[model samples]
Target: MTKDTRKTEYGNESISSLKGADRVRLRPGVIFGSDGLDGCQHSFFEILSNSIDEAREGHGNVIEVTRFTDHSIMVQDWGRGLPVDYNTKEERYNWELVYCELYAGGKYQNNSGENYEYSLGLNGLGACATQYSSEYFDVTVFRDGYKYRLHFEKGENIGGLSKEKCKYEQTSTIQKWKPDIQVFTDISIPLEYFQTVLKKQAVVNAGLRFILKDEESGETFVYCYENGIVDYIKEITREDGFTEIQFYETSTKGRDREDKPEYKVKMQIAFCFNNHTNLLEYYHNSSFLEYGGAPDKAVKNALVYEIDKCIKNRGKYNKDEAKITFADIEDSLILVVNSFSTVTSYENQTKKSITNRFIQEAMTDFLKQQLEIYFIENKIESDKIVEQILVNKRSRETAEKTRINIKKKLSGSVDISNRVKKFVDCRTKDLLKREIYI
Candidate 1:
């Protein structure tokens, strides 16, 4: 065999090929699903997700985001900071390894109840990829009476992780970086967009303080909620006339894994029908699900099922009109669903969808039970809702009948002599210039 062919056969382009940082640097889209401003904004989310993960794990309660005049962004959190120990094999600080290496994090095996059960940075590429895609990244960690700092430029360590003795008592982490425009099309963080993201995070976290400041304008905004998603729903639907806000929350035991305790799935949902608009927002493990997934479908199913039951129990609809479609129920529906599970399977690296079917079934059953009880207890409100459903059905039927009548009139037998007279009397027969009414 030829030398090149023998080398190819022996796997010459294997482990000795490309490094992780190089791979990530070349393909920023793989980490964020875009290489434009949207992906650059996602890098901020990747870093912010770390802070939220800490809060989710019962660590700190305060997170601060600052936009500097130098076009740089910094995120600071009062959580357990990154470790500063030295790795004997790599001969580098643990914090350095976190940024300089890929697939290295404390989330590999759930840490046997010591670490987070549900988090956004489970893939171990959050901070590393952020660093690899940035022109300059700096991290500071203060833990246990010591302060550590690590700085990097384009994924290369500038001065390495440095440690110093300090009298600090609280553990904290600060990450600041500038996005590489060559790698990303734009990194300008939209203040309003980020405000919405942080607001949603605060609503989910409940009592976790999120402070955002613009250094240039001196404008600051703080977001913190004590009642969680319920408060969020009320605030959003305050202007609209809502019937009632239905809330259902539960924690169910999931199947056990090898040597791990039974996984627990925590879910909370709030939905209401207002007289104004329809909105549905879903989240999993503190990450927003823009495209929606099984859980969303489950909620929709439960809603339709419960409404149909209500209609039947009230004797409002006959056998022919018993069916209630999603469009009918979705009008003026405002819903917020939050779910967390130790074991969750998202569709892709973007984590925009939850692909687990078990979640759907569980959510459907849970909501169905809650709604059944609610309907039984709140008969008056239930009757009013069913009335609205019937009204929607009538309106739809009337519209359909009108449309059919119009179609029949247009398709019915016509007089050819009358048509010919109309066309001939027309001043212009040019389709573009002529106007006709039938």
Candidate 2:
């Protein structure tokens, strides 16, 4: 349907008609992506991603994702399990809503939301889509001193959940389940994909250790990045050899004169340079907002201002023709950005890319002020970086001229650059396609 075709204002008739399971189909595209194997993997992403969020919350430090020969995928997390409550008045477990209903999660309403305040689950259909998309699905949660199981097939419920002996201690629940073959069109579960995803999560999330054990295949893989995004910076920049892996980390908590203690921010920036051409850069949290957002606008201005002062002080650039490019600043440069908060949305993961501040100008300001201090104090590194920046400037100028010449040859004016939105980039934007492409 064209964007103009759908009614702008629809009634809630279908909304109520949608049984919890049926609700999943009206927007199955919203959950599964394109009704393909990749979408099946996304079903796994939702569960596994939630576990990763648990790790981010400091409730636990391990995540386990296992794929069996039957193409049945099971993610066992060492983190806290889902809430399994026996509604005394209702006489049934709330797992039905937790698993099959949309917007029925602890993350909703921010009640006891100390952990998942920044959760992607707040998107609200985590288990809702899991059940509708799977032919056979079972959720085993160990929480609040109980082990509970909720089973489903296709989109229909089979009845009430059964309480079982908890395998996990009161602290953490052990789990294992099979995503039925009928619903998951893809029969092949690649070990590399699992490894890569888990590794990325380990590096991005930092201290968590995720383990994978396939009983049928009798294979096991473990991933835990002690250094977190710092190691991730190394992995990406390994292509280039960086000199001096200087790192600094500091966390701030409590009210910022706003009298709200829950507002917390953790920052980590690591700077290094390598031999390769590209400045390998990775950012988590709000630092990435500088990628052309309001925050980026602020930071770009501040960065240029700060660097210009430094250059003038050092008396490095006497020519007005010289220019400073982010690329130049990043030449052979490796920078890592890490931020955390109790209230934030990472676009789709627990990465915390956006904050309640809405306008991330403050994040940019924080980065610029702190980095300026860092560059000033570490002049040896600053000099090295400045030299690298000059080289980058020369290269960028050359590339710009080359591009302009190429464009001029083709047409008087050419599209400077083309960028696709995150939604469009993913094969299926129907489901939450906000995933790490790499």
Please list the C-alpha lDDT of all candidates, in the order they appear: 0.83, 0.62
What are the per-residue Cα lDDT tens digits for candidate 1 across 1-438? 566543445555555655856777788898889999888888889899989998878889999999887768999999998776787876876776688677787776663565877877788887888999999999889996889988888888887668899878689999999988878988777778779999999988879999999887899999998988989888878967447888889988654344655566889999877767778999999889998897889988998999898887778886676487877877767899999887777887678998766778889999999989988998887777777777777787789899999988976755564656755455766879876678
Clashes of each: 0, 3
Q: Judging by TM-score against the true structure, name the best candidate.
A: 1
What are the runs in model 1 whose C-alpha is more than 4 Å off?
Answer: 1-17, 88-92, 256-262, 400-438
lDDT tens per residue, model 2, 261-303: 4555555656567757444333443223323333344445555
What TM-score fits each model? 0.86, 0.74
The alpha-carbon lDDT assigned to residue 398 of candidate 2 equals 86
Number of clashes found in candidate 2 = 3
Query: What local lDDT score does residue 222 receive in model 1, on the 0 to 100 scale?
Result: 96
